[model samples]
Target: MLSTVLLRQLTDQVQELHTTAESQLQPLPLPVLNFKPTPGSWSALECLEHLNRYSRFYNAELTTALHAQPQTATPHEVGFSWLGRKSYDTVRPDNGKKHRTITHMNPAGSQLGTEALHEFLQHQKCLLEMLAAAQGTNLNRKAVRIEFFKLLKLRVGEALQFVVAHEQRHLQQALRAAHQATTAPILVV
Candidate 1:
């Protein structure tokens, strides 16, 4: 069970992230959304697609986890485990470290369309819904396992925070991709 204060804080962060991502990515044209800085880099659409994939997994997992746990009489605010805390810190945009993503989490390819943006926004909506659902649940219970390591589990609150931070990191990536796309020099074939 998470403290009301913590839940409020997390909710605020998720809302802010959703607003920023929507404002930045929702208005772009298809060409700009799909532009990659280079062959190896992700385009803005690719970034959103990658995030959407993770969001799909986490949203479902969180829903199931929330359903499985019963409400507790005395809910306390529990912090993350060491591993969970480390994982959450790693995904923050300020970390400045680029980690390699698991193959499954990577976007399929470039040439994506604005529908990716729509899906991304929908995922954000799901996240907000999940956050709202969590208010009455025991967020300190071991609810969800890490996607990469099924052996390890995180408290529900920790998992939500980690997911939000990951979203923030990728939103920053998408914004950077969009910025690069708009500024890049074009060459006629």
Candidate 2:
């Protein structure tokens, strides 16, 4: 994909995600945000917290990587490395298959509050800024080191795509939890 095209697409996705959070998720009450479909399932707040954890890591890494590159025109093409493709494919929101969360990334059972939602919104803003900063840099250049496997590095474009995909995956989970909370029948003792 052309570097500009890729960045533009990712930027749009981030903006839409932000809008969804504001429109559909932010106004939810605390009880609904904390509702879980099942005991083992994450609540809406927990899902956002999980995304917050990841954003803390990735936003910083992206900043460092973008700063290291000299300013230049956007590259003609943003090619995905094999590892990059696999990483992004695994997290695409439509994948539907469940993947185990890494231990540290799991936010299950945490006493998350409304601030989790606020933090996620802030993170999305940071991501939008990073994407804008990335436009003049070469997307194919290896920039960000993978969070889990630090030895492996992803191209700037790859890292951006993976982050956005991962966010989308969790955001959908959060939305579902919120919907269930709002629609589920109340129990009376």
Candidate 3:
């Protein structure tokens, strides 16, 4: 795909994510946001916090890498590398496969609040900025170091795709948690 087209799609996804959070997730009460569907499952806030943890790392890396590249005359068509294709495919929402989260990135038992949602929104904003900066850069260049494996790198386009897809996965998880929490019977002692 053309780099401009890919970036535009990513930009739209980010905006939709922001709107979804504000409209659907943001209005929930604290107890609802913190409610877990099952004993070991994460709550809505935990999901957002998990995304926040990743954004903290990825946003910085992407910003630095984009700044280092000189702008091109036109957007280049972007293609995924072998590793990039594998990496993003694993995280895409439709994959329906569970992967274990890294310890530090896991927010399973963290004391998260509405602030978690706020942080995620802020991260989305940063992601939008990064996407804008990515235009006219070489999307096929392996510029971003993967968070899980420091030595391995992804092309800039693939990195953006991975990040947005990851967010989509967790956002759906969070929405499910919120729905279950709101609809489930509240047992009183």
Q: How much does candidate 1 score in TM-score?
A: 0.90
Alpha-carbon RMSD of each model = 2.7, 1.8, 1.9
Candidate 3 all-Cα RMSD: 1.9
What overall lDDT, based on C-alpha atoms, would model 3 receive against the true structure?
A: 0.92
Query: Weakest 10 consecutive residues, lDDT, candidate 3?
Result: 68-77
| TM-score, candidate number 2 | 0.96
lDDT of 3 by residue, 28-137 (tens): 99999999999889999999999998899899989988998888738677899999999999999999999999999989888888999999999999999888877778
**Model 2: ten consecutive residues of lowest lDDT:** 69-78
For residue 55, give model 2's deviation from the true position in Å.
Answer: 0.6
Task: For each candidate in the order shown, give its overall lDDT on alpha carbons.
Answer: 0.81, 0.92, 0.92
Which portions of model 3 miss their true places by more than 4 Å?
186-189
Instruction: Provide TM-scores for the models.
Output: 0.90, 0.96, 0.96
**How far does residue 76 in candidate 2 sit from its true spot (Å)?**
1.3
Per-candidate clash tally:
1, 0, 0
**Candidate 1 lDDT (Cα, 0 to 1):** 0.81
